[model samples]
Every structure is written in structure tokens, then in C-alpha cells.
Target chain A: EKSSNIENYFRESRLEEFLKLTKVTNSYGIFTAHHLNDHIETFLMKITRGSGLQGMEGIKEFIELNGLKIYRPLIQIPKHILLKFCYKNNILPNYDYTNNSNAYSRNRIRNNIIPEFEKINPNFLESINRITKIISQINNKEKIRLFNEFEKLEPNYEENNISFSRIIFNDLPEFDKKLILKNNSEKLSSGTFMENKHLDYIIEKSYSKSNNFSLDLPGPIKLIATKKRITIEKLFEIDFQ
Target chain B: EKSSNIENYFRESRLEEFLKLTKVTNSYGIFTAHHLNDHIETFLMKITRGSGLQGMEGIKEFIELNGLKIYRPLIQIPKHILLKFCYKNNILPNYDYTNNSNAYSRNRIRNNIIPEFEKINPNFLESINRITKIISQINNKEKIRLFNEFEKLEPNYEENNISFSRIIFNDLPEFDKKLILKNNSEKLSSGTFMENKHLDYIIEKSYSKSNNFSLDLPGPIKLIATKKRITIEKLFEIDFQ
Candidate 1:
């Protein structure tokens, strides 16, 4: 795994540990204190990495994975507020030294980029929170609309494969088309989301004059565009062998 | 004028000068050397200022104002490429000394924020340009759709005032609702756009239990929401007096 993916790796490992602990303790769910500052830093990081609207929703408050509920109740509360609360309650919060090491992009954003934004607007975090709230609301509506359009296409799903009419797909709006491709690709790949470039490649090939074309997506997914239809299928190790 | 608006002031002054020069020289239009780097800087600035999707489109490549067309032919080209071409041609480009001043947010973003982004991705500018292109395409389609929705309401327009059914307006999607308010506010105010807070205030009040309410927008526009309809009117000096 790359250094950049270390954060995700740790997060997954921690969640797995939490799941095991939860089952042993018979707990209802897990709560992590990811605050507003962390949320804003993530938002900035996503923008720098060139994420689409779907990626700009910032951190979600609630998520459920493998029958375990994950909640971030402090997402709306700023870090300073949380720290003050801790101090008032005589609670000693652990300060991870790695956060100040600047070894990670998130640290760089927190130490460098956020201060610059604060110089522009003292309430930058709150402002970003408001904007992202609106964005998430819009994303929710768009998600429903996109699902409706995808369902209207009468897509056929067989095991790890999904297929839909090429003409109907082509006629959809560019945003919806890209989203539908993303949604289906994620579904077929068991939650592996394709990058914008991969989706763009599939869309471009699908619209090309050629009658048939095949491309490999990041999830080891196979996308075949024929004269009448487009199909995406996840490839397993057996198929590769 | 506030110090923050100095850039807009200079831009408008420059455009006026360009219009005068164009008429005198019998030129068709004006071309400005705003390259990809500048575009990315503006994008970062907008994000820091908590802009919505519409504001994330960055800079426009072309603008037609008062019968004089303004073009940014270098918008797609990177500043380094332009500098290299100028060096090869033995043409000296003037470097604005003020650009290095951290007093301006744009300068801070260009000097501080962007280098950090480069550390994350070597081709960050190109990535940003691609994302913004997709965003602009989506914005264009959304603009047309929003206009169609606005027209479906069959709004009444007279002089500097426009009115539509409150129930119909309330029924539109959140994104479309905000955008329609923006579009109409700009139209009534002769291109002055209201901030998100003002639009949110209007929307919130419109949905309140009160049967009748009135509020002032940034453009000095008056928004009056009644039981059956909502009206927005630009207030002139005479009306204010």
C-alpha cells in the first residue's frame, strides 16, 4: 500500500478492532470524535485532489458497515470547542505527535492550508460546514434522481455483471450518465469506486463510432460496449488465471 | 469600497479602458492573458471563501459586456508554458510585484497553498482544470434546466420586479431553488448576485408559518413573500428616498 493510503488502512483496521470489541462487549454501536476542523481539512484535501460533487460532501455523520453502526457525533463541533469541553471536564485528551510531524497530507492541510484560509476568513471552518451541508443536501436529491434514471434504463444485473441499453444511457444528462456509471461500477465491484478517468474512458468509448470495444477498469472490472448495449462485469482470480 | 473588492474594481476599470481602446482602434474584442495557473488560484480562492457549485466553475474564458467582447485565449495554457514561449521569443513578460504580497488572498493561495498541492500531485493544475471543465459542463446543463423550471412557474416580470407562485417555488429541488433565486436576483439587480446567506434567509422565511414577510437582499432588492406568491424588486435611489 502507498504512504497516502496509510490513513485508510489504519481506519479500516481500527474499525475491524472496534467491531470485534463491540461483539464481545455487546455494545450497540461505535462513536468517533471527528470534529469540524477535521471535516474542513478533508474537504480541502478532496478539492486539491480534484474530486467531483459527490466527493465534496465532506465526512458523513453516520455510517453502517457489516451490521456495525459508526457514528461521528462531533462532526459539527469545532476542535477548539471540543478541547475546551475536555479541559472543563478535567479530561486529558491525547495529542498524537504524528499530527505535528507533517508526514501526512492531512497534517499538512491542518498546519498549513487551514491557517491560510483562516487568514482570509476567521470563521472559515463554520462557513465550509454550511456550504458542505448544502452540498450534501443537493447530493442526496441527486442520488435519488440518478437512481430513478438508472432504474428507468431497466439495467440487467447478473451476479457480478450489470448491463443496460447503450442508446438510453447515451441520452441521459452528462452528470447523470457519469453518476450512473459510478453507481453501477461500485455495485458490480462490491463497493470499489472507479476514478473519474476510468468512468470518462468508458463513456467516451461507449459514444465512439466503433460498434464494439472492451476496457479494463480499476476494480479489475471489464466494460464492453457493443452496438446495442453496455455491460460491466467484475473479473475474479479464476478468470484471470 | 471594501479592500476585498479591490480586485473587482481594477478588473472593471481595465475592462472599461479596453472597451474605450477597442472603439478607438476599431478592434473586435479584448484578449487577456489569464492562464491555467491563474484559473486554479481563483478556484482555490473561491473554495476558501465557501463558494457553491456555481462559483467553482472558476473563471470564464469569454465575456461579452456592453457590445465589447473580452476573451481569455491563454486560459487553457499553463503559465510555465507561456513563460517558456515568451523566453524563446525573447519577449519579456512583466511580473506584477504585488502578486508576491501576502496581503492579497489570491497571492497567498498561489504562493503557499498551491505548492503544498503540488507536493501531493505533480500535475495538480491539469487535474484541477479537468475537474473544473466537467463542473462547468454540468453547471451549463443545470443552468438550462433551472431556466426551464423558472419559466414553468410563469413568473411575472415588470420593469425591475419579478413575481412567481410561492407554492410552485417551494416545490422545486433545493439546488434548483437556490439557483433560481440567484438567477432572478441577478436579473432584477442588473447583474448583482446575492450571497448564499441572503438567499437562504429568503427561502427560510418563505417556508415559515408567517403568511406575509419582507426582507432586503444584498443587491438592495426587496423580497416579499406572501401566502400565495413571492415577489422580488430592485430598489432605486428614488425608491429608497
Candidate 2:
């Protein structure tokens, strides 16, 4: 129901799509034709933008959207092959001129970046997919590990907020601390933009004696810390989906 | 001193230049004219080729090479800016034809890919530098943290290798396990290409009930597991240098 040619606005629209699709569709997924080039571009984008393991994971084949699913079967298929298939079958497809044009970040990545990457290693895209597949398997196990670890942390929750003591958090491993911060902030934004810098800052402050401070994070959420606890909540009353 | 016309081989040669320069230089430093673009290319290469946090940390202004140092004072300056200065000052520089050719991976990335990334995010290069700066700071702390953590691991040793028991290794966090493996393997290769995949393999096998297996890893290192311990050693005696 929404589209944005601009890169900055694209994420905003995508975040809200889960909610929109919930109203219109049955439990079945809304299928997309996003192919290999798109996935490769995403990998490149995450790298260029300085993302972590999650960012490197690229796009998922299936994403749970409320009760519905967003499925992309052609994600692993190369765009050239898809074009070849269309051409061989004598099917005329509408060309998106914007893709050919260098308007969007993703378009620029696909058109300009990936070809150069291909020249480096022809199998580069597939290699990234290989890592993605392995990491996804590891993450499946890690997801369960995180929830179980979170139980040890003993978080307290109100209707709109969750808080954890800094005492135990400061002593945890760096990744576990990151997982706890990410988990605490996940529900604050559907856009999923809470970044490492924000989490790092809060984690840093938690160790210091500074009693009270609130940091405005990327989800546009607020992470407020008092003498003993840290809490994250949405600053605005907007539902994602 | 070995120099690579193509950036791909350049980094490979750069890795081992430490030992090579140890033989030649009189303990001062070797300087190069690598500007900001080259640094950016290395960052891009590391990302496309699937690197971890250290890869994103990019080039250091100074690198310790035995008694000598590899220095790049002009690393912060962009190529075009250097060219502009050269033009304004009437400085004659030798023209390199290979840069115009699409034969090298780094050249292709620099000449083709970067300009396209510029179209997407004008601040993209600077943004990466900013991350590099921040990560470098954290990595400094992390380096100390790793050593401190390693001390607690209390590794055992024999004639050929340092060994950690699976019972204790399996109990450690995933990243701690990775740090342990990496710390142990750092002596194996000065090239620094032992990736997460290789480490993950050894870590995975360390926990499994099955023992007495040897895993051949990238960097040509072997992770040999006995009933009680896991050992990582250079699979071959071939010096990459």
C-alpha cells in the first residue's frame, strides 16, 4: 500500500507494511520477487553502513509479520537468470526505470557496486549467502540461548517499559550485554534501528556512578537510567504494526 | 620490498612485509603514499570478502614491523585532493596505467564501486572512518580485556602446542571461545586471515561429545581434538612470508 523512492523514507514505509498487510491479507504471506542481486546489495549495504552479524545475515526467506508471513522464494535466484527466464518464455515485463537510474541506495549498490564485487569474486554473492545460511543456523540456536540467558538477568516490566539492574549487566560478557540491550529495545520500534552506539553508550554509563541520565536512541526511544536500573520505552505513542 | 600493482596482492604482501622489512630496514620506518581512497578500498575488500570487526577497523597510521614500522602519514587525504594539490603545485608524478585497467579487484572497487556509493551516501567514506575511529578505541580496550580473560582460561601446554580442555572451553561464552582460539592462533600466521568460520568450527567441535578428530582450517591451520583437548597448529611449515 506504500512505496518510497527515497532511501531514508523507504525503511519507514517497510516498518509499517507489517501492520498494513495484517488488515488486508489472510494468514498467508504476501510474496515478493526480490532476487539474488537485491540480497547481495543488502549485504553490501550493511557492510558499507557498518553493521554487525545481524546486518550481515541479509534478508530472511521468511519473516513473521504478526500472524502473517512475508515470503521471498526468488531471493537466492540471480536477477540475470530471472531475466533470462522471462526472455526465453517470451514474457514482457515492465522495467522499473528507477532501478536503472541511480536514485536509490539499493539501486546504486545493485547497478554499480555488485558488478565490481563480481569481478573480484564471481561467486561473491553466493559466498555471502553461504555465510548467511550458516549464521542463520547459529542464530536459531543463539535465539533460544538469549531468551534463556535473559531469565537469569531477571528483568521487571510495566505496561509500557522494562527495566534491569546494572549490577549484573556490567559483569556479563560483551555480547550478552549487547543481546540484553537489543532485546530490551526490540519492542520499542518496528523499524529496528536501535544501533550499537546507543547500546554502547548506555552500557558505558551503567558502569559509571552517574545516577540519572536518559539517552534518546535511534528507535526514537528513550533509555532512562536511574541509581540502580535502566529502562527503555517509546517516546511517542505510535504502533508499528 | 614487495609492492603490488593490484590492491589484492598488495594486502597479502603487506601482511608479511614485517619480516621482509626486518631483514632490510635499519629500525626507523618505511613510508608509503597510500591516501584515504586506498584505506577505503581495503575496508571495502574486507567487507566483500567477509571480515569481522578487526577488518572494518581499516589501516592503522602506524604498524609495528619487527624493529621497523610501516607508516602512512597521507592516509587521511583523499586521492582527488592529492591530485588537485599536485596540479596546483605543478608536481609531476608518474602515471600508472594499471589503475585505468579493470584487471585488479581493488582498482575495480575504487574506480567503479566507490563513486556509486558516493551517490548513495556522500558521507559514506567519512562514516566508515568514524566507525573505524570508534571501533579502534573499543578494540584497544578489548585487546586488554581479551588478555585478562585469557589469563583466567589457564591454558595447558605441551612441546608443540598450547591446549585448552573441552570441559572448560565448552563452558566459556562463544566470543570468549573465539578470543581464546584467535589468541592461540595469532602465533600461527602473521597474515591474519583466520576467519570466524574456522574458529566457529573448532569451537563447535570442542563442545561435542565426539573427540579424536582433526579439522583442517583456513590459514592452512589444523584444529586437532583429542579426548581431553583441542590443538590448533599450522597445518604446513610453509611460511606465507
Candidate 3:
């Protein structure tokens, strides 16, 4: 019941949907055991796709998505350690079939990329965790705190579209700029949605006198900068909201 | 002529030696072709080893190091493009024997980790380049400018030591605080010196009324904070300097 149809086929939104669906019957949000492997793969994927600093920061320990709080408690513990724990407790771990196959880019990264990274530096995973922790520390400090304060502005990410108030987002600092533009804008093909420059261009354009201008991103993502709203949508997605 | 004994063994200070040795009869600074692949590999290695934002910015187009300008003009051009350019221009590129074998951690990253990244995103090189360019743009703007101003404090990275002004660094904005603490302070065994937590801890300690307090980093790197200075040095480096 936790694995919904949307999550089974795709990665992004289904987790929140599943959590919300579960919340109807259960109490609080869904707590998960998304281990270090998951976090590391996400990190690998982020850099590969040319993600900005915010995107490269793997996963939050607690994420409020779609009004549902999804908590990942075992984010720091590695898969091997968990397996060892299971062994010590005399409990057999379930081998998820999905994890074994290369059905998704994530699986490929987990099965292939991380191993190669391991070969380069035996403590590579630990190093990534240290960096992740450091980035988390930074986020916890002044910049992220200030950025979070500006969350009063309601930014919406619908099915195939992303929209936020143009005037509100324009004059903010770069950290806030990157935060809002991070996941809210993305292209369907290749990796990385819009880079810092792309996001900066869009933000800069939103303030200009031209009321009707659209910027084309790689892989059919179009950012339409109307007078009041800056919207990002997939050009190929026929049912875009 | 290219791979000097200094460069063959060392990664940091030796580059200056190689340049100086080469500049015996040369007119000005030594320019080399450090292609995009090299840059990308370095970047991957940097973040994997808990590098800060400054460290993750792989190679500089023009770096003035140790009274010498080491210029890498083809840094923006990808390896494949350079290879194609070589083929079209009828120029035979010299094969660096070091790059061929996985004798070094960097070689392993270049030969192993990057290929896996490529598999995840075919245009991963372009993505890295895009991110690097974006970072360059950000650096061009503000954070980097402020950080560069702080560069007047000559932070030395000796065999077992790294030292800069404790008083000046303590009162900096977070960006400058982050920059100085990055490469200038690192564990002697690993890639990255200090994480954000370590920096924050040091910065926090610097302001305290205590005259002499010492904080130990990961393993051996000790940040000794005195009345007038904060010094970082490996615990085991025999020579005190």
C-alpha cells in the first residue's frame, strides 16, 4: 500500500502522494529507512546531472512535501551496516527486486557508479557523508535560515508546470534564487534542469519591461516569463497545467 | 618535458616547481592543455573527498601560483573535442603515461568513476562544464570577490602545517569564513581539510574569551587557538613549521 502506482513507475512525486494516502489511515507522517546508499546515489545523480549546490545536497532527514512530512530516520546508517544489524538480530532482509535491476538511472548509479567511486577511494562513501554533513551544516546556518524565512511566498509545482510570483522572487539573494529554482525547474531529458546561469537569466528577464518572453531550456523545458508570473513547463508534456 | 619529477609525485606545490623549472628560458608563464576530462575528474574527486565550494571548482583558467602564472587555455574544451581537434588539425597529442594507469587516486577517478557518471548522463561533461561556468559566474559576482579580498592573508600549506590570521578570519561574513577554512585546513591523510562544522567550531572558538584552546580535526589535524592566533597542523608532522 505504501508503494503507489505513481512511485512504482516514477521517482519524484509519488512518495509524497503515497505518504498522503497513508496519512488518511495512519497517524503522523511515514517514517522511512532510506539508508546512506540511497543518499549517496542521489548525490552521485545530482552532480552527474549538473545540479546546483542545493540540488547536490542529497535528501533531507525530514521533508515537508504536499503537506505531508516524510521522515527518513536511518539516512546515516549504510546498507552494509543495516545488513550486519539484521544478521546480528537473526532477521533475514528482504531483497527488493527493483533494487537489483537497472530499470532506472538511480539503480544504474547504485549498482555501477558507486562501486567505481569505491574503487577510487575506499573511504569515498564516508567522504561523501562528511561533505553532505558539512553542506547540511551550512544549510542549517545563516543562509538557509534566511532563505526559509522567505517561504511565505507560495510557489507551486504542478504536474508539468512550475509557477511562482515573479516580483517576489526577483530581488532576493543568490542562495534563495538557487533554492527556489532548484527542483521547481527541470528538463525531461539529459541531466540537470536549468543551471545557475539559466535560472539567473530567467530571474533577470522576469524584471525586464518585456511582458511576454519565454526562455527555452534544454530537453523541451520552456520558462514562460509573463508580466506577473514566471512559469516553467515541459514543452513536450501535452497536458501541462 | 611536460611531466616533471615534481608533478609526477606531487599534486600541489610541485606544480609551481614544474613551472619555474620550465620558465628557465621561456618568455612568460607556462600554458598547458588541461582538458575538460581532467577538470571534471578533479571536481568529482574534490566533492567525493568532502571538498568545500572553493575546492570543487576544479581548475582555474589562469592561476597565479608561487610567483608564476599557470594557464590552462583548453580547460573549457572537452577531451573528446580536443581529440577531434587534434585529429582535424593533424596534431598528435602526447600520451601521458600517468593518466593511463590507475597508480594515483586521480587516475582511478578519471578511468573509473567518470565513465560511470557518463553512463548515468551522456552529456555529463557538458553538465559539469555548465555547473563550473555557473560557479564562475557566481564567483565573478560577490562571494568570490569578498573571499579574494581575504586572500591577502597568505595561508600556507606546509608538510604538516597551515596557518592564517585568526583575528581577521573570525569577524568575516559566512562566505569568507567558509572559503578560508576550506583548503587552508585539511586532514593530512584525506582530500578535504575541514568541513563547515569544523570551520564553524573554529570560528566560534576564536571569539570565546579562552586564550588557549585546542580542537582536533578528523584524525591528526589540530586547530590550536591561542590568544592572538589559530594554527592548524597535523599532530604527527615532525618538523614544527
What candidate 3 gets wrong by more than 4 Å, as runs, is A1-23, A95-102, A137-241, B1-26, B96-102, B134-226, B230-241
TM-score of chain B in each prediction = 0.78, 0.75, 0.65
Across B64-140, the per-residue lDDT of candidate 3 in tens digits comes to: 65456789999988898889989999999997664443357786777776777788789998888776765565556
Task: Give TM per candidate.
Answer: 0.80, 0.62, 0.69
- Evaluate candidate 1 by giving its C-alpha RMSD to the native, one decimal: 4.9
Model 3 local distance difference test score? 0.67
Q: What fraction of the true Cα-Cα contacts (under 8 Å, chains A to B) does candidate 1 also have?
A: 0.51
What's the DockQ for every one of the candidates? 0.49, 0.27, 0.47
Best by lDDT: 1
* C-alpha lDDT of all candidate models, in order: 0.76, 0.68, 0.67
Name the 10 consecutive residues with the lowest summed lDDT in model 3 chain A: A1-10
lDDT of 1 by residue, A1-241 (tens): 2332444344445567889999999999999788998888877777667777766778889877645798999999999999999999999998655343234788788888789879987888977887688678767877888878888887898986899999889888777788888877766543355787777887787777889998876554678888988998877632211
Best by the TM-score measure: 1
Give the per-residue lDDT of model 3 (tens digit) for A103-189. Answer: 478877877777877876777788888767656665566355554644644566577687777778777776566666655553222
* Number of clashes recorded per candidate: 0, 0, 1
